[model samples]
Target: MSAARHPWWYDAVVYQVYVRSFADGLPTGEGKGDGIGDLPGITSRLPYLRDLGVDALWITPFYTSPQKDHGYDVADYRDVDPLFGTLADLDVLLETAHGLGLRVIVDLVPNHTSDQHAWFRAALAAGPGSPERARYLFRPGRGKDGAKPPNNWDSIFGGPAWTRVPDGEWYLHLFDTSQPDLDWRNPEVGDMFEEVLRFWLDRGVDGFRVDVAHGLYKEATLRDQVRPKKPKKSAESMVERVLNDEPMWDQPEVHEVYRRWRKVLDSYPGDRMAVAEAWTQTAASMAMFVRPDELHQAFNFGWLGTPWSAEAFADVITDSIAAVSAAASAPTWVLSNHDVERHPTRYGGGPVGLARGRAATLAMLALPGSAYLYQGEELGLEQVDVPPEARQDPSWFRTGQPGRDGCRVPLPWAGDAAPYGFGGPDGTQPWIPQPDDWAALTVAAQEADPASTLAFYRRALAARREVFAGADEETVASAEGDLLVVRRAGVTVVLNAGTTPVALPQGEVLISSAAVPGGLLPPDTAAWVR
Candidate 1:
């Protein structure tokens, strides 16, 4: 929290734009882009986001890659992939977005490089003990005949983290095989990333949304990860993973990297900053990423994963506030992202899930800090069950389980049919097919209805803007039995998580997630009063 010179992020609402599925830039007959979202697509949609009242937008990776894990596996750190658009297109997007009075943050993936990257290619060409191989985690296999991997670590995508090359040496990929982990112990890797940071900052971008911020470094000793000793409870799996002390995640050396990168950000004007996607086990561990000498903010996934209960959300929020307060930083809240199922579907499906998700969002927005909104949640979009043949997420291939394709479906903008105004007028079919049932979820339809989820979000954001204009980080939660109530900076936020109706507090109501009948808030409803 080395006080970002531009403090607009103090309570900013950032919208996450899933580039490939958001809106396609290709015209009806375009060949290269097919039907994927690109820079131009985003530039075309800036007015929509601005009108939606978000302070900034964070786009997922669009850099050059093999698309093995989509754009997360980077082959070139400097250029935009042709599937997305060109550099000139991105430059235009930055200009247009800034003109609309909205900030932009692009994703930065530094944890690993695509195996097709020049460095990795050179590593393969060169023999063992070569300088090129030193850039990535290349280790000799263990056991007889060098058939076994170096350790028992598993990839986040599935399977072993180590992949054996023809040369008898094994390389580490914490994710898909195409994404090989970089050796951060090497100073050259650090120097190369510094250049990458300066490249984007010089392009007039506002900041970066760092991908895998906690994964840049691994234990130098290549130690085995600690496993759960007892029969693991599904309820405790997340906490177990966090405190498991995994050797490859949340390493101390990762902080040193951010400390240096923070200096690069501080050097630029316009309040340049970075937000870490560090999925640390707890708020205390997560807060470590945003200390005085490090990055500005880290996503609080604990708040996002909490179940539907006043006690659950309250406990997480209390811990988050207490931890961030100690570090003199603000905690960020988010309900959905490109990786997880949409909250509307996770909160329970259909109408009940959507209502609970809306109420949860209202609760999060009412808190005194920054909040990140996934692209389609405002439209009450539920996860789509993409057909098996159409599924593309690598995790689906590695593990037979339903992958993240559900949440990555193309958004519907207009029209009553498939591809639904996705690419453009007469836009081609979406890369990941949009469902037929999404007809009513289109932005066009939502705009026509005053009671749509989009409408609720607009009013909620406006009210939130007023609540945090000059608000303090300090907050008080005086009511937390069945209903969750918090008083912050002269505003009171009450959420009815219980199963029955509750009396509304005495104040001028600013906004409500759902209709209030006879001054009584319905179950799974949230309201803000001042």
Candidate 2:
């Protein structure tokens, strides 16, 4: 964060685009005619995002995939999927986004590839002991006939982690069966990934968001994962259960992979960087991914999961700053992403939730580091309750889990009915249906309302750019019951997380998450003061 060495991303606000649900370019449904979001749709939305005040865009995978886990399972690294659009469409997106003053970051799913990827297909046809099979994790099952899986590990999406082949070998897929894990122990895998990095960099993409950044390597022994005894009636918090320091994620060897990737990024111009999606046991553990020689940033999930309380926020923020700063890297924060329920829904799912979400964002933007804004968050969109039959996330079909379709529902760009302004004026049904209530949250509607959530975000981001973006340190001005306050550069951020109001300090209020009545920060409200 030093003046001479500071990178553009150090204080940037990045927007995450879950491409398939973001927008649809082809009014006629480009490839599959499925009406899914595509590169063209993104290109058209560039000006809107640039105007929204984000410094960069982190676009999720749209690579050649079977769509089993949406785009996380890659069938081909070098080409675009037909269901999304074409390579030409992608080039147009990159060119347009760059022209709009946006840095585009695509996703890199190194943990696994689609079962249909050439390497995996060749591996299957190469039989049990062939070199092609060595590129992936293929282990012999247990028992005399090898009918049982090799270990007790389970997939992140649920069910057994290993899937059997007709050739009598069980392949590891920490996610879904369609995405077989690659063997990072093999030099070929690393070399190929390096080439993939160069291909996109050469194509002018800003960087990559490394998926499951902690999961490229597993324990060498491939030992059975240790398990804690089942608790009585779901006592463990969702935050604790997520990632869980599980055997499948956050391995020490993963750091080496990122160190190499950092070198690749550094070789390129325009201050290219990579942000890791690494879920670790604590903020301290998460910081390992962003060491100077490794990635530029690691998502601070421990901070993201902290309860809506003054105490929880203070403790998590302290640990996040200390650990990340120790690594000489800035902390990256996020509230909602494609994989999680929208924050408004998580906060409490009504007027209270929306208020809390806005306050939380103001506090996040007040912090002295980079932050990620999930698409639709600016409009205060909540997770839709997708019906079972309409659900598309593989996790739902595989494990009967609620799945992520609720958050991945197609965006409501405009219009008051189905499809919104997503595809085009002559749009068809969306991939995942948008709820009826989203008409009130469309960008067009909010753009005209000063009190709208969208307007609130725009103002907050502008104020940050003007007041807080350059500051690299924060000191706690106050952290008492129902209130937390932090000072950065001369600005004070006050958050009232408890019921009732807390009197604000005597200073000119720069911006407030909501209307502050009688100079008091109301419950679930946050404000920045000069």
Candidate 3:
């Protein structure tokens, strides 16, 4: 990590905001409605972000998109969509975030672009022989069968990875057919992506959260991916097709590209950082993206898919810390994002299970690394049930998978309102319907209740701010056993995984997840002290 890179990130707590479902500024009259949550709408919520003690905000891709994969399928890099507001709106957001002392990191999907993008469109219009087509990875059909694709690599959405272009040859799409993967092996492709980075950096944006960082490259030989033994019809199968398990990730060339980008970032002030999304299960593989010449940090997905257990979480966290130590960079933890089910849903749903979810949040923050908290997670929001007819994600539609619609529901801001204050002023219908229970746990309701999860998070975040204020990786200390304990600076965090209260060394209690008198911590509760 260069001293010139994003310093705000080292001791920061990042709040991941999924714009489409966060807060819709516009509303339609129908009971079931769809409207855009423009940049202005996000701007209006800066106060809420500040109150949450978030030093940084990581918004999912908001570039011009086709909505195929929410905003993951970017159609244009430079232009801002009319539905989501314009370039000027982004300028305002950056200014507002910086004014509030929050560093803004936008999602950058450099691995691919929506097939609807002008480059892809021109490639199709110019035919396979055109030089413009070479910008993307295109391969000819197999043998004499001109229609069949070159290889059988499956798409993350489903079906074949190769999409037959409107012309002759087929182009590679690691994800949905609408999203064609870029050819990172090509020098021009590298240059093109670098230009995109400069565009955002020039806009005064702090940094980027690289989407599918590992998928940027692939095996030079278009080999068939090893399919799962018992191929079930679930999202995991799609992942088996094309994800971090591939040999393409952490490719030598990818490191060179990152090194170049890191140098570019070093030229800026306040220090910029790039957080890579590596979807591997083990922390060992994750470290590759955060080495001295690679990404500043990579998503530690070990906890994301693991079963809910304190012991298991301890192992994952310990392994992640070891991985970061080996790479000379700290790890990053993400409980939930647009791609996975919310933590509240994953670790047993409903109010009774909230302690488990909060325990996970506390565990992540207590560790010595950059932590990512998904939007609405602080409110202990559960996943929304999406009817089949209401599903829009291509992954779900084409693959018949449940997809991530459950976790990407609209946020609940007002105490009692339609779509939970995610819609326009009257709280009308939003782009996605809020969960039935959202109104009860809405932000307004929680804001007024001291016992609500929102308040707990405020206290927890305040604690984090105090502990991490002047701390570093070396300042973090750990204690082993069923109850995982971490101490940073003067703050000691102890999480009780068992059902009974446990004794702690004599010290004043800074905060507790449960109202356990004295030093004992209730089941699934956490406590912090000096």
Candidate 4:
């Protein structure tokens, strides 16, 4: 699709804001006030985002919840959570973001709802076989004494996927026990989510980031997971096994739900759209989520999950671009987000990691589709090792895993000390403590340093707008000596993953992740040349 005909999201660069860690506005309880980030705090930071050059902001779930699984276990989809702010605060945020020319996309959790949600509560109160109970996946036990779970599937957060209630019926909860998966087969479920989508669109949200978009539907037969020859140990490996043709995930029926949702988004004005957080095993399967009549964009995690090598990057990018193009939808690239370890840390931690991360950022921006930047990435922030006592992610408790607390540490906006101006005027401590060593990495520090990572991001983003705004064509020039060269529009981006520097193609330099010495791109560096 051409830029003129496609929606703004097609060429947009989106920033993912993890709300609780972004900033704190209304501090109301203990320790210099509650210290949890709120909608008002996000509103107050609109100018910063606009200056950052992101076309839109995708805020993580801030809906009413009981704090289980953070805000992902939403109890009410229509209202904002008290921990974040009131519905009015969201209105102010939406208005302010729009005023600053930044679109806002909120998280939409359709696969499940918190056990405390009104419908779930009613389902619990009603007897088995009641219509209210039918809203969720409540099934009878399978054993002769009705003692065993209906299926042998495991929860993503660890433990059996089925949780037995007081009524002796088992309910499916793919994540946490408090987050019961909804039965999308029911017409009420689909209608409710459609209305939910309209409710937010009516409130002026630009679009939605559909959470677990591949998981809304499951196989009709709740069969046991097909076991592998050898059991996977680590959480990551186990997840990979489950995501590959699992009965409960990436079901073909899920497309029907998005086809209907596409109509809802289309009915709204202002080019509203939805991006799916679908996790499929292959690029083609991921592409299916963004078919013409489905979501506008689906995250290209194949690119995200690829190893730091020129060949690996080229293969994934080639496949991703081809798949999405075939589906007649724009591809979406994401390097870091709330759920994973920051790319900086993942690339190899410390200075080397930061260099690779910066290079990766430029390479991602050079692509011919939308990109998503996690908060704090521009500051070259590395994952902070939160003390075990300070970790709040439910995955840590459920799986005995370290969880995602490291990536969710509060952003250091300014100041040289802890909290780092992340809180309100009272200088409250952030929910998760910031590392004292991050003084030099604060936005204030980076803004003053022209050669800082933050500055590089600003220049790269600005250059992208100038050179590749409507440029969709991308051709792989060459992959030689661990260096990958890609030509997009009239701009050539050279990424060197090798240990030694490499000569750049003949062109004027538009931007570089690092200073080019002797007209050669340094190792772990990337540059855009016109």
Candidate 5:
């Protein structure tokens, strides 16, 4: 990552690829199930990513893991899982990405590790009250009452947070029982994570997309939390708790940790960046994750669930800019990810749903900050309807609710084939079944369709780079009803998120969701005009 002629991410587009479902080069039955997608698969897709006009790529966790959390439960920080590929494979992918002018940022789960990890395993075998035990938060094992967990805290996956070790005291897991939280307060813990940070940075990787970053620290008292008003569990619950808004999350000390990371980044020849997954409802809380010397960006989820009304959308943009404008940082918007239902499903049901998906993509990219385009989104892929019998998610199994399989459906690349485009060689099944209707949505099929959403994205990306490329930070002009108008560098973008078309007082209609030239927006779409 040599210093770009311009700032690395300024006006740059980002594409996020979830490793397991991206592409399957080794779609064979020799390894764990159908281990199709590997580093080579990603390297093979670099040209496609570059053609999409994305300058930066964020690959989800591929580190050595127990797969209990689907790579989130990291077992080795410095090693690549054989299931994904080897370190040599990673180097090839990195070299290929840079050759194509794309920067690579891998996911880093700093909050917890698999209980099978050497540290956790050692702590588990060390018995009670050992100094090594201090590396993790452990409390006395109880009796009779199934040994009540050390505290009343509940796992993000459900049940008590404490999991009793067979031979020792219970250990705390903010998430699943197999993913134990790391003790960041311990000097040794900090030192270990710092080494993990340097491992990739030293290897020429650009930076990281930190996972559960705010959840790195827990309450010192380890007290139980009072559930929020919407505590009722549902398929839509992306998080077990509203941890980002909690007092202990972005503690002042967290800044110090980021400062150290920033220092490490500075030691490199290029400008390395880090982004955090912090879910907060307001701009004020989201802004806390970004400061002069801390994280480069925090995922602003305020718009993730926002109504498609113009006023509501405008308020989010306005408030977000106001929150961070003074701090001289940028904002990021992500509408879809591996964890939640696809936007098409969340917005509506059918072709109308596809329209909503395209509309939202344009709206997010048209906004005044760096944007994240999820895998399959450019093709307008809808969520799969996962039946209960075939579900594999722990949350789904525990709560009897559908899990992320809907959004995490296998990717479709080839045209109209069984298992869609993700079919493995020699009749091997895909890791996750693709939507039956994915044949028409396969990347190959859409590649030839000029009116397709896929084409719309290519044009949209060009438009973003052409119009908003060097524009200064934008400000809200008016946020009324289903009309949101914003201006940056003398250009105003007015979006209509409603069913009926709304009147615009100024600016020509540059682009519309339902406009000619196969615009990406659907229904009453967003428009940009002078």
Candidate 6:
């Protein structure tokens, strides 16, 4: 596709802002004084984002919620949570971001809602067999005396997916019990979400990052999931194992939801779009969410799940591009998000990890599509070891696992101390504490040092805009040993994942993840050559 024919989001570099941890506005009113990041905080940081060269920002959910699953369990679809600021605050944020030439995409959680949501409350109060209860997936218990759950499916977080209500009927919650899944089969449910889409579009937001896009529809039969004969070890394998033919996920019926959502997005101007956070086993299944008439993009998680190996990266990139291209859609690349461990930490923490992270990010940017960057990624922030008591992710409580709070720690902006300018000068503590040792990782500190990760990100993003923004072609050359070479728009990117130094192609050096000594690309480094 030509650059002119493509939408703004087609090759946009989107920055993901986990609102509650980005920056705290420190409002003295209501719950705003509790030191959580808010709309005003995001608005205040627009200049920084503009200078960073990101084309757009994808802010995580900030809607009204009890925050059981943070803001994912939204209580009110249209209003901003008081802890994050108000709806008016969001309007200013939108206006300011536009004025700064940055597009804004807010998260839309359509799969479920907070148990405190009015609909869920009504469904509970209205009891079984009522119209209100029909809006959600409420089914009668299976066993004698109606004491058992309707199905044997387990929650992604752990435990049974069904929660029995006081009236003896059970409601399905694929996540935390506080977040009950809605029945998308209900026409009213579909119509209501369409209105929700219009509400944000009319407010001048660019688009939405649809949460759990693969889960809007479930098998009508509601049968128990068939378990694998052998237990899967890794989380990715387990997810693939369970969801491969699971009754509740990646159903063909779910595509209809996006088909309707596409109409709502098309009704607005400014190239409005939506990206699906769908997790499927293969690139083909993931591509289904981004069909021409459906969502504009779907996250290519195959790339994210791949390890730090040239062969793994090459295979994923090839599969992802081929699948999404077949659908006539640009692939979306993401390294880090709110849900997983940061790439640097995952690559193997410390100096080696940071080096690999930079190289990986450079390679991702050189690809032929959109890239979503998590908030603190540019600063090369490693996942912190949050004290168990300080962890807020529901996964930690539901399961004995370490949880995602480490990646969600408050960002280090300017200070040398705890909170690290994440909040106001009053030293109000961030919701999750920032590590005191992050003094060197602060934006202010890194901005002064050219060798710093933040500096590298700025230079890399600027180069990406100047070189690859309008480039329509990407080709991955066969790997020569552990060095993976990719050519895009006349620029060649060489990534050396092996321990030995590798010879570079005869092209003028543009940028290197680390300084190249003696014209040889060192191990765990990537270079852009033109």
Report the C-alpha lDDT of model 6 over 1-530, residue by residue, as the tens digit: 77778789999999999999898874774533466888899998999999999999999999999999999999999998888888899999999999999999999999999999999999999998999999999999987988999989999999999999888999999999999999999999999998899888999999999999999889998998877787778857855663655888999999999999898888878899999999877778988888889999999888788898888788778778889989998988999999999999999999999999999999988898999999999999988999988988998999978899999998888888978888877778888988879999999999999999989999999988888877887666546679878888898899999999988888888888998888899999999999
Q: What lDDT score goes with residue 478 in model 6? A: 48
Better of 1 and 6 by lDDT: 6
Off by over 4 Å in 1: 1-6, 27-33, 234-242, 424-427
Cα lDDT of model 1 by residue, 1-530, tens digit: 22244388877999999999887874435443367888788898899999999999999998999999889999999999988888999999999999999999999999999988999999999979999999999999999988999988999989999999998999999999999999999999999999999999999888899989999899998978877777567875755655676888888888999899989999998888899999887788899999978999999999878888888888887888989988888879999999998998888899989999889898898887799999999999999999999999999999988899999998899889988888755556887888888888899999999999999899889878776665774687644678888888778888898899999989888888899888899998988888
For candidate 5, which ten residues in a row score worst on lDDT?
515-524
- TM-score of each prediction: 0.96, 0.96, 0.91, 0.96, 0.91, 0.97
Superposition error at 392 for model 1 (Å): 0.3
In candidate 3, what are the lDDT values of residues 1-530, reduced to their tens digit? 44345356765789988888776653335532245566777888988999988889988878888778877888888878666778988999999999998889999998899988988888888887678787788888886857888777778788878877655689999788888888888788888888999899999988899888877778788776565567557866654544434554555567677888888888777688899887754567678778877678888888676666566666677777888889988767778888888887887787546887887787677777688989989988877788888877788877998888888777888856566666555445766666665676888999899999999999888987676554654544344555767766667777776766788657888777777676677777777777
User: Which candidate, 2 or 3, has the higher lDDT?
Assistant: 2
Cα lDDT of model 2 by residue, 195-258, tens digit: 9999999999998998998889998889888775664346456455654546677888888998
Q: Which candidate is the best by TM-score?
A: 6
| Candidate 4 lDDT by residue in tens digits, 109-195 | 999999999999999999799999999999999888689999989999899999998889999999999999999999999999989
Position 386, candidate 6: lDDT: 93
Off by over 4 Å in 3: 1-6, 26-34, 166-168, 227-248, 473-481
1-530, model 5: which lDDT tens digit per residue?
12134467644677888888787664335633363466777888899998988889999888898788788999999999988888998999999999889999999988888988999888877878887788888877556655677666777677777888776478888788888888788888888888988999988898789897777777787665555776647745634444433543555556667778878877787778888887654567668777877788888778777766777777777777788766567878888888888888888858777777777777777777688888998888888887777577777765677888788776788766655545455444567766666788888888999888888888888888887775664455566666677776566666667666556546456665666333333335666766
In model 5, the clashing pairs are 24-36, 513-521
Q: Give the candidates in order of TM-score, highest first.
A: 6, 1, 4, 2, 5, 3
Give the RMSD in angstroms, all C-alphas superposed, for model 4: 2.6
Clashes of each: 1, 0, 4, 0, 2, 0
lDDT of each: 0.88, 0.88, 0.77, 0.89, 0.76, 0.90
Using alpha carbons, what is the TM-score of model 1? Answer: 0.96
TM-score for candidate 6, please give it: 0.97
The predictions' CA RMSDs to the true structure, in order, are: 2.1, 2.3, 3.9, 2.6, 4.0, 2.1
